[model samples]
Target: MPATILIVDDNELNLRLATRVLEKDGYQTTTALNGFEALELCDQNPPDLAILDVMMPDMDGYELCRRMRENPKLKHTPIIILTALSSVDDRLQAFDVGADDFLSKPFVPAELLARVKVFLRHLEVRAVGNENQMARKIAVFSLRGGVGVSTLATNLAAGMSQLWGDETALVDMAFFNGQSALMFDLPMRNTWGDLAQIPEEEIDAEVLNQVMLRHSSGTRVLAAPRSAVNADQISEEKVSHVFELLQEQYPYIIYDLPHDFSATTLVALDSADKILLLIAPELASVRAAGMALTVFEELGYPDEKVELVLNWNFQSQGLPRGEIEAALKRKLSIVIPYVADSIVTAITMGKPPILSMPETPLGALFEDLAFRWSAPEQKKKRPESPTDAWRRIAERMRKRAKAASS
Candidate 1:
């Protein structure tokens, strides 16, 4: 069935124009000349998405949006605010009132269509997985330190959240000295320490939600404790329970693991849907990765469950890719090139490359990698309307395949 969109504008011509543009694309559109009529229409039948003009009689777009968000039936509906006001303050006010996107008045029809398509595509992707679907847990681990394990985990989590616009969890399992919160510039308001005192069976969704820190990129972080003593109080049982609860809440979870097979680390590794074993180009990193692989094999993990990721952390005196692959006896699924300056700057600014510099080579690489690790069901089926991020990744893949063929 074609998705329905509700267009609300006081101007008759503006309403007709928006309606015509949407209907031309096969979307069923209902028009309203005022906020009261829009609410009445919505009460009768809710739309999959809504386009609202900010300048309306009696009730402006901001109030209309707030009322819709308050309505149980319209709370999750995607809203795009259209207005002549193009100031940053106006855009921020629109967002504050729960608008998903903003467009200027006299907007290009193509731009409107593009934005609508993206929202609908996201809705379709979300609908594909119901409540029964468990989160895809990805654990980034390295037996050796300083191999950019935490860096990769942060980028992957942030990238996935940005791509899907869904809440992705980033669990800092490096409880002793995890920097996941710092990477995103989140304050350590609540952490695993908050959950440590609670009995494992007593920990529930509401409690977990309080402990998780929200990021602008839609990534919620389970930050490590500030004190080592608090970290030590977190037991393996608590970690297991937290993972089980997180799987129910988030569609994706990224684990930034410590450099040992500790009880807490094992709990995360054992629960992971996919394990990314990160290694640098040096011999020790390769040896450490090999040992980790052996342990995974011993633990009965399937070959496909664990993937090798080669990080070129150093600019010089690094082993070749072939040598590292030979030493580890596994093909590298992803290779992150050396971008020390970029990485350092991103860290210092409390931003991940994927969020701050998405157009840069490093940012694009992480974003693409995050998409590759998305939920299998989401990747297996193409969306009815592809999002811009999806199209960009698909185009990149096509170009790469073509180059290889030629």
Candidate 2:
């Protein structure tokens, strides 16, 4: 379908000429005689994109652009300032009013259409993975290594996608060991760097579509760079923006986070409407998890947000879930039994268990867990303070370090 473009101009000739040019290019054009009319039309029914002439009789383009942005309906519509006043100051003011692009007067019709088409194409990409309103969310996390963190995360995300009409995202926040591309035999190079460089002011869903990875399982993956310390760029502030965009964009945003606490971790904690705390039923890791819970509690994070999963496919040491929970003084939210050969075979084949053997007991367990986590919430009474959370988290880190040394 042709994307709609709202044209706002005082001069009827310009409106006629521009609308004709864009309409001929297969755009659904809506013409507004002046800024007031444009605002009214936009307020009544929003457009996908807009074109505004800067100099109008009653309301100029700058003020009109500001007005359009003030309305939530018009905020995401890419605004084009088609104006005769070509001065730098005027262009700056146009941008100040939130113009996406500017087209000077006497502009080639092709140029006008070309820029519009570019924005429209990007706009389409921006809309990727944004279709689902009801879907399950799962967080893959760990405090210890080699406990199948990536394997669990990848397969769980892929498994849940099938449950949600094949719409999901597998995000790798481990900048150095990012294996999303390698997991499914996808390419090594991507636009993750491009996304990091994008200023917050210019960021939107459309821009993210151009950067995120899309797996064949219908799951979109956003992986971090394997070499660069790009982790810092993906901070809690920026990560919050990215996750919010992804949560809306994809049915499920699979977070592949690091074992340690950092800005990204805080973002993960905040972003997780639900967090799957993956832990090995070992003495060391379980103790570390206990400390992590204390840190989360001090931070004011609610216990309801976290679902603990004990990966007991390996050696259980005959310890019960109650024993672990009692040691930590918290409840065991969820548990995933060790699936010996199934776990190994899934990772060896470079695929998640859902795809490796969708019929297996292992895959079936994850499917149920996915649904269990997806259940709608009642109300969670939780508060997280920034400074105190950090201090307590630091104390937890010290304990973990002491345990490691001992």
**In lDDT terms, which candidate is top?**
1
Error of 2 at 186 (Å): 2.2
Best by TM-score: 1
Q: How well does model 2 score by local distance difference test?
A: 0.70
| Cα lDDT of model 1 by residue, 1-406, tens digit | 7899999999999988999999999999998988999999998999989999998889999999999988989866878899999997997788788786788989999989877875676455445654757899999999999999999999999988777767789999999999999998766657998898788888997678767876657788999998898888998888888998888878899999999999999999999999999999998999999999999999999999999999999999899999888877779998999999999999998899988998889988998999899988888777777756677777888899999999
How many clashing pairs per prediction, in order? Answer: 0, 6
As for candidate 1, its clashing pairs are none
| lDDT at 46, model 2 | 88
Off by over 4 Å in 1: 1-130, 384-387
For 230-334, candidate 2 gives per-residue lDDT tens digits of: 545655667777777776766566777778777776777666777777677788878778777777789887878777777785764747888888887778766
- Weakest 10 consecutive residues, lDDT, candidate 1? 121-130
